[model samples]
Target: MSAHTQIMATVAPSARFDPDLGVIMPPSNGMPRSVFGRPVAPLAKWRRRYAACLVVLDFVAAVAASRTVVALFQDADAGFWDQRVLGDTVSAFVLVANIGVPLLWLVILAGAGAYDRRALGRGTEELNRVVRANIAMAAAVSFLALGFKKDVSRATVAAIIVGLLVYTVFVRIVARVALRRIRRVNQRASQKVLLVGRLADALAVHEVVTRNAGAGLRPVAIHLPQYPRSGERVNAPVPVYVGWDLVPLVQQLRADTIAVCGPASLESYELRKLAWQLEGTGIDLVVVPQVTDVTGPRIHVRPIEGLPLLNVEEPTISGLSLLAKSLIDRIAALFGLIVLSPVLVGIALAIKFTDPGPVMFRQSRIGHQGKAFKVWKFRTMYTDAEQRLEALRAHNESDGLLFKMRNDPRVTPIGRHLRALSLDELPQLINVLMGQMSLVGPRPLPTEDDDYRGDVRRRLLVRPGITGLWQISGRSDLTWEDAVRLDLHYVDNWSLVYDLGILWHTVRVVLDRRGAY
Candidate 1:
């Protein structure tokens, strides 16, 4: 074992665990002599401490971004940064700013819990926290200036706010990516979890944890309370220790967490007992709620009269926010079409001249609430392509419900380049203006997919998007189950910040041209 994993050997004598209680009884001091019976890795605690380093990095990024923005416009012809603050020259103003700005921003981030380990590596929540903190910092500074009668360039402050916010988010994103990569490299960094539940629940939870490598949960073993001590065969690949001897199993396997998935073999009282036993054992106890695919914002845990009551708010794509979304879509789509008018005309000409077919293909797609719409796209396939689809069925390469071929013979030579660059999907900006689609949403399904009668139909709750979680995830390459899971996750967890995050990822995915037809 690595020296880092040998700390357990220096601890006190081990306590014999009661098999029925699943934990060693606390000694006179009311604490177990040694919670970790074996060499438990220090990585779980160390990861939290790693956040301290990010605080320094964030401060540096804030200062750099503030200085760069000020320097850019300080000498501009517009004279934007010519104002003085309280008889102070621009130098003194900058000096005060250099010290004050980073400190306030760091304080805001800290207060928002952005630097917390639980928030790190979580994309939407972390980004939302940072963005909200930045906005709040800007508003407070603006108010302070007005109230104190501080003369300063409003434009300079605005530019600094925008620049610092973007730069800080970029720096944190880089940090999160680096931390994830580092954690993956060190096996000890991953959470070695002991799953205690029914066989079915164990299998399901294992699948979720295994598939989501970024979740950082590694199932070391499974213990089904429903099974006997002799043990029954577990459907999962993990070893099934078939008793409630959680303390011994946790210690022997060096597990840091006991993740209980829903109420299965264990009742509420049994769960309470298990929590009580693991209290002084130092093993983290997490109960995975039965509500799956819900976003963090909607899942509120309220402590009500000593019982934790979970409040799952119903997700709504309506109200003023929905109106704001529609307005944003219309405004952005209009601006994009105007700016890219030349490119659109060029694509139209290219398609018409080379393919000798219509520039746009309108297909019947199921939209919000089973509403049908003719979604527009720059026709990448030849006029006779649909007629020939049956012939190429055997060549379909998509692992999902959608039919896709890497090199479809129906595509024109020019069409391949357009599809590869995602230029073909540009025409859907018009759909955005028409209110038939949003800038981001669940991708509209073809009418043929209507046969899917599962909760998959819930996707129709919101207007279909030109690009969405599936498009950003893997598109045609994703398994049917994965594609459906992502779409449903989007449906269940849609938020303004979540939508922006998806839109951001969609850009990267499109630029990479992955999983294209």
Candidate 2:
């Protein structure tokens, strides 16, 4: 026997040491002990399935679009459908273009993040991206048509564009609904989640995961920090054990995946050591970020000389980014004004008739760079609600400088419902158009609020968003510390992709109507 094995055998006569679980206990001998028995490879399977679905959808959309274009022209000129033209020149061109367009579309879709599972069935953001990509593709095709002096009919092209848009959108919507249902079913069937972190972090992680059953994680057990065994039960619906016992617990629970939310004090060397030990095990390890509400696109992993370097690019909310935001805001606001005119008129009439005050409420709040700006909202509260604020301060449930009360008596009946569903914030689309706010950014804080701190004040770096990370991530239910952390995370890692995600999630959050007030 090797010296290390001899030493271990001598130290524990009847025991087998499990490196993953850090346990030096009795061996079950010929009896198989379940250690690290989860199906980690299944995630790869799911990814493959997801990619296949996307390819099929893309192909169908492309073929339908191409056929529609061909049919439109063929109907206009019956001679175009004949064996001579169709069999040779037209047939060859259509066949090549049909296949080429789908392949090119797949590349464009990948670049636009259309296939990301996290983005499936999210919102209009994905649709917007699809529209932009299709427009670019159309432009390219138009340029080719001009260069070649091709006799492509505008009606055919238009039909193809419309058909592709409808097909892609319909397929995505159906996919999202189906996936959500599958997730719900999976939760009911019980999937195991192995949580690896300090006790405190593990408990918090467990709470969130359990609360959101749709998130698809079931905490089977927690691997606590190394050292003296606490022999204490965790508050979660799972067992808590010292780090050394993790491997055996994983096998016992048949966990599908392991999520590691290591403590802030965890050393990189220790993490590497643990990773090495778990390398061959069929358990998938996912590292949870200490920072919350940050999107993936904002995080760049650079390998320099074999070391993984995490780069967090500072958000550029000014100059070109600001200009882009301004353009989007104006376009959206103008569209909203045109599309929601009836709704706006009704709201104005109701407010004017029900209350003696103006239909709109304009309040001074901190904007970009601590600049004061008047923020507009459809008036939902009594005109004297601000004057009555101090008396209701004791009822404030929000953790930071912000004030929020789910059951505030000062809220008018109309205002309460409006705020519940975020209808009160609709007028801010105008603020967005005016360049005082953005479609997606940090929530603007009132200058008078005492909660603004040193780093927290960085939220002003960008124009306040009508709907932001905060708005989607529990809003008033979030602690001040959590709120600030999320805002800073956004500032550290802002990207067009991240912004689109926030916008997409915002729609879901609004529809769910959880923690809104």
Best by TM-score: 1
Question: Lowest-lDDT window of 10 residues in candidate 2?
Answer: 77-86
In model 2, which regions exceed 4 Å deviation?
1-63, 71-84, 88-166, 181-192, 204-213, 229-237, 243-248, 263-282, 289-298, 449-451
- TM-score of each model, in listed order: 0.77, 0.73
Per-residue lDDT of 132-227 in model 2, one digit per residue for the tens? 767776776677668966656676666666777778777776665565567667653334777878877877778767755555567866666664
lDDT of each: 0.75, 0.69
TM-score of 1: 0.77
Residue 340 of model 2 has an lDDT of 84
Error of model 1, residue 331, in angstroms? 1.6
Residue 130 lDDT, candidate 2, scale 0-100: 77
| Model 1: worst 10 consecutive residues (lDDT sum) | 3-12
lDDT at 239, model 1? 53
lDDT of 1 by residue, 1-517 (tens): 4221232232113423234423222223444334345344343665566577778888888888777876777665443344332245766666655777888889888898887666676667788888889888889778877897765566777887887788888888887667666656674456789888876787788987776455577887677675343433234475555533566557666778888877675789877776776766567788878886786688998998998998999887789878888898899999999999999999999989987868999998888788888898999888999899999999987655678788789999989999888899899999999999998988877755466587878888888888888888777778777888888888887777777888877886788798887
Q: Model 2: how far is 4 from its true place, Å?
A: 33
